[model samples]
Target: MTKKTQTPAVQKGNTDPNTLQLHKDPAQTDAAQIAAMALGSVAANAMTARSFAKGTFGTLDVTECVMTLKQRVDTTHGGDLKHAETTLTAQAATLDAIFNEMARRAALNMGEYLDATERYMRLALKAQGQCRATLETLAAIKNPPIVFARQANIAHGPQQINNEAISGTTTTRARKTRTRQNELLEEPQHGSTQLDDRTTPASARGHTAVEAVEPIHRTTKRRRESSGGA
Candidate 1:
């Protein structure tokens, strides 16, 4: 019986619950989480402000016009409204300042979060790529016992054992040579050359026109009057 080399999951060490290994790099992830949480806190505070948590005045209640025609009357709704309006206006300005501050803080926190997120995203992507490369290498060498031992002792240092990349320069050169040979030996076969119908052309133009047709099938459930059952 042939033994299976290594399962992809096993090779990648995906048994761990954490998508990323926390022990490998905890500080960075923690910093990223903190930034994200700070942004959330700022947003929550902004929401509370909108919910009138501090009772910021939305509108000032002003009387349209309650004019008294009585001469020497001790009552005055006009004065009361004027006083209320003046007080509310100043309060509204103060509320505006508070709202603006909340918005500023929220924006500032969000900016930090965005910056942190961008940084971590880049890091995560790089790590993910590295993990993928490692898994691929692991998978490629799982069957090869010699390579398995070589990869087992893999470590970062000045003496990095790299596989020399054989570039496609030779392949390109061969292709160019083949192209030149084809040019020298071959003639334009499509323009002037004629091909028999039975012998299909080496370079034939494909038919593009689609034949239009009327619908041929019809569905019927009724019996004809002349052919009706007696």
Candidate 2:
């Protein structure tokens, strides 16, 4: 058994092109190889760097999903990608310092970008609301009567639900009950007289002195009537 191995084209010393059936114009091998390399490179880098940049511009895609090196344009003469990349790499020290500081503070690579974007959005919304409120207030101040939009009476819970009418009725009934109870406790006084028994005797108080003297005249009249009848 023999070990198999790959062999290069006709050796440099071999000289029989027709008899050995070796290839003519040996430069074809080099040209074919160069062509294969060129086509492979082109196929590898079909998406230009500019296209990748546009795809990723202002978008918050994850780091793992970012553009790849092969996505950059393939060229013997370096283009904008070379310059832009060189410039960016030149400042990589500063970027690395920023990244280190952020990491020390426990920041994720994509989290910083996303956090800044979200913060900006929130601030923008807050500023918009403030501007709107300011405009409304200024408009109100300019008018003579200064009519302002009424704020909605947002009831937080059951505190104000049917509370006003019910509370008023309960209060009124309580007051009326208190008034009736007070009137019952407060009685009116009738007319009153003041008297003293200081001058009256204990025994003769039953008959007055004028009533005792009235019997004398009645007895004389009765005696004259009896004589006339005899």
Candidate 3:
């Protein structure tokens, strides 16, 4: 007959429920209880560490717990955003109720006691402000404000704004030149007179048509005086 080998069973210790042993796996029941509790990270981790020693977590590790919490937060955030309008509207309504209650209490306490009345009025104002803020938030979420960029004329690829400017300047200079020419035309010419009785050279030469020549005199004042005296 062959000899049979027997293995020793795992040992269990009795320690304080609030204290953690340096080398022991946490009770499965404790892990389950902490996991089911709706506690924050700090409290949860403290309780979980105290419950689970030997750096052993049953069914879930610290990383797994963190990931589970993160997933839950993500889910909650998505749900909240999905129902943001309804949630904000409900919150606004609640604030309105609170405002009304505070106002009613203020009205009742008016003139009887200054402190109580002031406190109630202050609370009522605070509630009214909160309600307004909630409604504004809801409105913003529903119809977000559109940011309209200022209308701009953006030029691309080395656009020359000065091209048009130069053309405009040229046009202005041309106009000025035309104006000067017109002024010169309107002004009387020096030492020149119109002779209505003058006839064309062709008429004078018994021809049908031809050019006429007019003499221009360049006389000084002394010569004019001598001529006038003569």
Candidate 4:
């Protein structure tokens, strides 16, 4: 038979436990809120870095430097200078590609940030709207409800009604004015029409399509008559 082992019971502590408990103090919470606000403020005011790699040795105007080097390379004929130029050109192109890649990555990061911010803003707006609706619903249950009076005085007031009526009238008047303007534009004054007729070529202004073709028909008839006579 296998020997069985029994586990011993843990003894209770004889000393009293410390009364102190971990809790967030109001001051600490306030400090954290302030810190968060400061961070947010800093972020809001911060400018985008022009160079992705700051303090790295070399000029930021890589393209301009490359162009200047190319100009020098064009003038250079010595083997040593040509070799140096070729090396430099290659290095400059590589640097340009590096900066380009950095800029591309930065743009992608900015776009992602914008998308996140936009989504957060939309969610915030929706939440705010829901909260407002809830508040309004609660306010509506009160004796002589404040929202109803405010809505009646401001939102659905006589002034608003009058404004709507005036807007409609103005819109109708505008439409009529536009129609009159269009008619005036399309049908010029009698004197202006006469002036236009005087300035325009007779063939272009006066002749109808069929009337314009009459000259061609007359020429064809004359040719036929001559041919018959001959």
Candidate 5:
């Protein structure tokens, strides 16, 4: 029998969960957790919006309007929500940097801290502005006036009018072509010099005589060819 090798046991460390570790700060950790939670919530909401767009919510009550708005958001501002989420995540990393710097120094300069905080705050405000813009766009999508304006623009555009005219002309030409083809198919094919009632002999039943005759010009040409051959 072959001898089996035993795996080494993992070592455990005596570290305090609540206390800040070397090169790590508890404040930044807390900030990171908060940011993660916030981002998770936003992601969850976006998923819910997507479900609403799919008509998961029954077509009853005020949910129908909500569903419509959700669909419009998905169509028009698809990237907005993701961009906002990304901005928040980046800001969270910035927060971690800020807090790490604070942890490194025994005493931080108030002026510098204030400046960094202000800059971060501006970024946060910009993210908030983006969120607000997305909401405003959703509102516009839901607005009847805006919807009607879009419809009217589509209906009365010069290109649309030209397309309609071209379609009509094409349809008319197709119909005329079909009618001509049908007439050609229905008409009898016969040589020229059709026999008239006076020239044709009457039938035994006293019916007006109708006979297929070779064209006079063709008969004459055939006779000339035969004479030349002879």
Candidate 6:
């Protein structure tokens, strides 16, 4: 006869039960987090691609799906600019056709002198304007306008100096040291000085100097006397 072994059992309300410990690897934990993030990103992109493909192509055809994705990629890569050029060109041609048809109907209606003749002429003019606008838009797209930016300084303090070349030369310009107050107070080297001094006579300041003039009649009488005596 064999006897069975009996195991001990703990009470239901026991606070100290059993516990197991495990060590974690830092490198493995980091790698696992990175993998999870990558998968989540892939799932998000798949959802986006599916939505775009469904909306654009209506059916998930492989060619159309790829084309739709390619369009998005092209837009990101600035391919829309080239697309715009061709689209505008086509629009301009369409507008020209519309203008011609409208003008022909207007001419025929004018000869008939019908009640809608004025309306036809009006529509023709409108189409002509629209065609002109389309052509102008195409021209603008082909040749963009050049923008000129100039820096200007406005203040009451000392004059501002610019380091940039005025025309195209790299030569530095002479500093401007003269102002309105300086001109009025300082004596000039070339022209007449505005300020009068005791050392320099007013006549020495050139034709611009201020001085009293003799009376015209007295000078004429003196000239006559000198002529008579001669």
TM-score of each: 0.17, 0.17, 0.38, 0.16, 0.18, 0.39
> What is the C-alpha lDDT profile of model 2 across 20-97, one tens digit per residue?
122345657866755664466443343233346556663322221223333444331454445444544445444445
Candidate 3 has an lDDT of: 0.67
lDDT of 1 by residue, 1-230 (tens): 99989757644444432122222356568777656634654333433444452366552111101111121122233333443344445555554555455445445556567765555455545544554555454444444444322222335775655343554787799999988876654556443243335755565565669566788898886876785668
Encode model 6's per-residue lDDT on 1-230: one tens digit a residue. Answer: 89898787865532321211113456578667556534654434544666676776554433334445457556847735666667678887887787778777778877677766777777777877877887788788788898766666656788775544244543322223345456666565634565545556345445657678977764334444454554
What shift in Å separates residue 69 of candidate 1 from its native position after superposition? 25
Candidate 5 lDDT over residue span 1-230, tens digit each: 99899998989553432222222456678677656634654434644555575576543323333444447557546544554444455665565555555444423433577776665565556555555665555445445252222222246445443233236678989999988876665444532233344665433343358677677664434444454554
lDDT scores of the candidates, listed in order = 0.47, 0.46, 0.67, 0.47, 0.51, 0.60
How displaced is residue 174 in candidate 5, in Å?
Answer: 51
The sequence of per-residue lDDT tens digits that candidate 4 reaches over residues 1-230 is 99889899888543322221123467677667656634642222221121333356333343333344446555653433545545545655554555455445445556568765555555545544554554454344333343322222356445552234235678989999988876675454422433244575333344355543344333334444454554
For candidate 4, give the lDDT. Answer: 0.47
Q: Kindly state the number of residue pairs that clash in model 1.
A: 0
TM-score of 5: 0.18
Which stretches in model 4 have alpha-carbon errors above 4 Å?
Answer: 1-112, 144-230
Q: Which stretches of candidate 6 lie over 4 Å from their true place?
A: 1-80, 150-230
- Deviation (Å) of 2 in candidate 6: 74
Error of 1 at 13 (Å): 85
> Each candidate's root-mean-square deviation in Å?
41.5, 29.0, 16.4, 33.6, 24.2, 20.3
Best by TM-score: 6
Mind giving the per-residue lDDT tens digits that candidate 3 earns over 3-49?
Answer: 78988887956534443233233654656655554355644665565
Model 3: CA > 4 A from native: 1-72, 76-80, 150-213, 218-230
Give the Å shift of residue 101 in candidate 3. 1.2
